[model samples]
Target: MSKIDIRTVNVVQYVCPLREGGSLPAIVKADDGFLYVLKFRGAGQGKKALIAEFIGGEIARAIGLKVPELVFMNLDDSFSKTEPDEEIQDLLKFSVGLNLGLHFLSSAITYDPLVSNVDAMTASKVVILDSLISNIDRTAKNTNLLNWNNELWVIDNGASFYFHHNWKTWENHLTRTFPLIKDHVLLQKATSLEKASEDIKQTLTANKITEIVSNIPEDWLISEADSMSPTDMRNAYIEFINAKLSMIDLLVKEAEDAR
Candidate 1:
């Protein structure tokens, strides 16, 4: 509805690493006195992952999905000295500057389809959001869905928008279909794709998408092989999202066929 206001805080402490993922995201405490799962800008996938996480979370929120509150975290170089693990200390040393964090949903358990039932609308929304972002992580293997306080919450969207990884040919994938939808954890539960698409069409306006894309830090858009300016990268993201949105009917069909 308006410019998305994201909070920025200084990371004060590195709690522990969620080492299961390659990014080595850690539970860090911020000056705001809150625990957040911090995604470092220096990690394997680097800032693009954070950008994807930022864009994906904002898009999920716009479509009325429950996503943990995302905030911009300023990581100081000094914090690296406190970390005893040399590997983690190196990550801290390199990730100095802006990073991304999701407000930790304490005690939340991973969603197991057999254990938790997701409603049709929410399931449909999740399917639609994942399709739009071309997210490749949410599968039977890693649902990436959390049950927080009895509500379905989406998390770890860093694997989305894979096209950005190869900016040279990224446009070729703008019209590509997400065949991987077949592996989606909620495919069978997304029974109302048409309705969900209709609803998202109303809320996820181009202006709103642009607003979210605009929040990506300028430095994150820079790459040695990529000469595109930050503005160009931002515009590319908006274009990719809208292009995918225009194909919602096709995506719905793909998801349906997958089942």
Candidate 2:
């Protein structure tokens, strides 16, 4: 896979807050004249959520999923002063540095699985990707998918890699099966989990995994309790992914049985 170069843009204007979740991500216009769904680094989840978004979105794109372009957005303190809402102002003030931004789809519609038709191959690939990354957010209740220009786009991957939140027990769960796959929105429509796993395994090479993990900003991987350095954290992520890839067959079986 080719290297993904994430652009850095300044936030020119604060449009509005997307009050859907607790993280307080907002829709902001950037200096590039493109609107972005900006995830604040100072939000409740902190930088780890941004790390997950970067890694998960890039991995999804590598395996032929349609994901919006990601960029590093610089938030200036002055921009927060214009906000009318006190809560939003506080969020903007706290996130004064680099934040994760997803290129916004202006007219995209939220994906409704009941009304939408996703083919078997695409569904299988999505399931495989989620399982590999241990994303527990893509349930039927909240697919985290968007429909735009007749294409399905994956979004909101910050909820992935839950194990990273507790690095102390990360090793124990590294080889564990993802039981959450049973509730995956695409599971019923998915077929051929083995083929999907093979396709992802072929695309997500070790170097590509390292590159994706390395893309995360050094400050985002802040060490806690002297557990590991930022570089070690990146290596740990690569190690976990590689270990998961080695056990693709087991994950595939788990998903298949769930379906």
Candidate 3:
């Protein structure tokens, strides 16, 4: 696996709150002069969401999907003072450290299946990846896709890897069937799941998975009290993903049946 470098930037300005979900990610201007959609570590869902964003987005990019470049944004308390909203101010005050940032796509439009035509290959790959991660949030109501520069970009993968919330049961849940693909926005339009499965198997090698999960910061993993060390948590993620990869064929069949 090649070296995966995630750049770290300083937040220069607090633009506005996205207010899309409970996490309340915001749009901010960074020192690098690029606007980013920042996900706060202090949000209700906490660091696990950031973990999913890093791992899932990297995997999507590895498997020939276009994902927004992810970066680490350093936040300070001074930026929190500028925010007018009390709730957002509180969020910023608590998130006074490393947070996840998604490169903001200027003039990007949300993907709508009715108006946007997606090729079967891209749709199939998205469906297969979502199923493998057991993402339950990419339904038609919330596609979590953006149409930018005449291409589709997958985003907001914080909702993937649902089983991670309960570490004790994670091993038992690794091989459980992911039935959420039935509600996936691209399900009906996707074809060639077998080909997508093969491509994913080739692209996401063990080394690649290791590199992806290792990108997560140690602090985030240790934020909550747990017996596992940061390295152990990273290895656990890799193990869970490998187990999921072993069942890709079953997942593909499930998606095919749903379609």
Candidate 4:
């Protein structure tokens, strides 16, 4: 695996929780003097969610989409000491280690399909990306997309790559059609899918796939443990992604038919 250069920061303060979703992610200030949206490791989905967030962010960026900078957040016990809510306190306790943070896009608004207009190429890329990762969260009801600085920035990909949730069934997912693509907020707007598919496959080289999965923190890898070691887990992701990569044509066909 090639060396990946990702930022690491110590979370200095828990600003407030974003209660819009059940997972309860929080806004936080870090030692670097930047505010971030921190995704806790102890959330119901566990560290595999953070792994998905990290890898998904890179994948989106690689496909020419804007994703907020992702950083590894170090959370100690002190950050949770003053919390008033027991639920949050428990969340802090379980997340007392490396969490994931996205550089907060101040004043960003949710991407409402009713109002926002995305060009076909950009929309196509996002559709292909969500399909490739099997992201079920980008539906019209809860589009995990934001409009920041007049640009479409993808966020909250923790729900993608769900194959990791059950090791026994992971292999079965690689070639399957992403049925959820039809529900994607941008699916009907994605007119350039064939071009987008070629571009995505061009960008996702084997080395790039390895690099993305290889960057998963060992902590996240261990959280998925029933029997596989972290190294084994990493290899499994490489295999999974490669299989998906090899069958991009199938995924594009699904996306095209869904619209």
Candidate 5:
């Protein structure tokens, strides 16, 4: 895990529920100043939720998006707890959550789909990354994109890769035809996005993809989930990131040629 600096004091004893699922609002003190409340995954969501936030947020940040900072927490489990239904009551009944949380985003007042900003090429890249990771949570309803200080910030990555069944199944997700390969938007504006795909392809082979997966935490893949082990799930993601990196070169070339 990469080192992240965050202040964890002024822990609010309770969590104020937010409209979003698996999250709550609570006040805390950070390095910048006092924040009214930071949004955290519901206590019932458990540690995997925090891990998802950490890894997913890091990937997006590496890809050059403004992602809110996430940190491990030490909070009382009583804040904003949820009751379980009959089917999975046992599982939910005994779960405790780490105060592991992210920096409170103060200015994200609303969510707007910037379809124009997200040109067809950029859209294709986003979709390609989403599909390869088996990320089914980024629909219109679940787009975690928000406008803040005149720019966009992305959030919520816990629902990705839920459909990964095996290593081959995972590998196939990365094998898309790259139809919109010509329209990568980041090619022109951001150097990071420029030629990203080609760079990734040059550096990341199947073996490297496997190594990335091998690094995932063991608890992330539910035992009953698609019969996947943490290793399988990790490998699945390795393919996604490696493919994304490879696409960077194509993106850069497209941008340069367009200019």
Candidate 6:
């Protein structure tokens, strides 16, 4: 297992906007050190984004993948000269000089997405895992998976809320379905679906799921977010994660019991 150490770095020169919602810089550290630049935002964005990153990353790490060390760091707003999109600029103006907490993922030194370091079987397993987790971030366009030195690493989990939308009333988003698991490579690696399923089930347990959502900073929740209390919102999210976890558990447990 890789260890992560968190520290502050002066990233003034490396700041750049990302193609996505935030901006960060590619930073270099002293020999044996690694770095990444994260955009700073006000407390208003709610901490849901960060929470998603935390949970996704934690789970990824548990499942035998390399996840970069993540930290919440304040940035000097003046460091990045490239003006943010007009809307982001206005939003920041109101907060005035507040440092946005940036999430730094150490660069994967030997990873390349365009090339496959793992077999196609492993890739299939990864896709199934992402699909079951409802991670909307890792589509073909983003392809956050990388192969470095014969190992695969997953990154950039900022878009993990596919199941958080209000589903109580059968909203349109309910159309989304968990991906088929039968042909997946990673899912098959399980001694039986039972082990993998139990792993996911434990992750989505009521308390664990609730903790993940509740831990989200108030700023990351959307403005005019659902009227539910944080606890209620958290409970709702628990149900969402449970839906998938339960399925995995059932699949794996029954298989294990049968054998």
TM-score of each: 0.98, 0.97, 0.97, 0.96, 0.56, 0.61
List of clashing residue pairs for candidate 1: none
What do the candidate models score in CA lDDT, each in turn? Answer: 0.92, 0.89, 0.89, 0.88, 0.48, 0.48
- Per-residue lDDT tens digits for candidate 6, residues 1-259, read 2333334344334344444444332342222243453434442333454555656765565455566655544344553334556655543343333222334443444334444455543454355356555666564455666555457777656556544545355233333454433333233333534344444444445655555556554554544656666666556556655565556544444333432
Q: How many residue pairs clash in all the candidates, one count each?
A: 0, 0, 0, 0, 23, 13
lDDT of 4 by residue, 110-209 (tens): 9999999788999999998888788989989999999988889999998998988888787888778788888999998999999998888778788888
> Stretches of candidate 6 above 4 Å error?
1-14, 19-34, 37-48, 76-114, 119-125, 165-176, 179-195, 198-211, 249-259
Off by over 4 Å in 2: 223-226
In model 5, state the lDDT of residue 29: 55
Q: Which candidate is the best by TM-score?
A: 1
Please report how far candidate 5 places residue 165 from its true position, in Å: 6.9
Clashes of 1: 0
lDDT, candidate 1, equals: 0.92
The residue pairs that clash in candidate 3, if any, are none
Tens digit per residue, CA lDDT, model 2, 1-259: 5788999999998888888877878999999999999999989888889999999999999999999999999999997788888888898888999999999999998889889877787889899989889999998788899988988899999988888888878888778889989999999988967778888888989999988998899878885654778887888899988888889899999999998
Q: What is the lDDT of residue 16 in candidate 2?
A: 83
Q: TM-score of model 2 relative to the true fold?
A: 0.97
Question: Which should have the higher lDDT, number 2 or number 5?
Answer: 2
What is candidate 4's local distance difference test score?
Answer: 0.88
lDDT of 5 by residue, 6-74 (tens): 444434433243535544434455444544334343345444555555556555554445677765444
Clashing pairs in 4: none
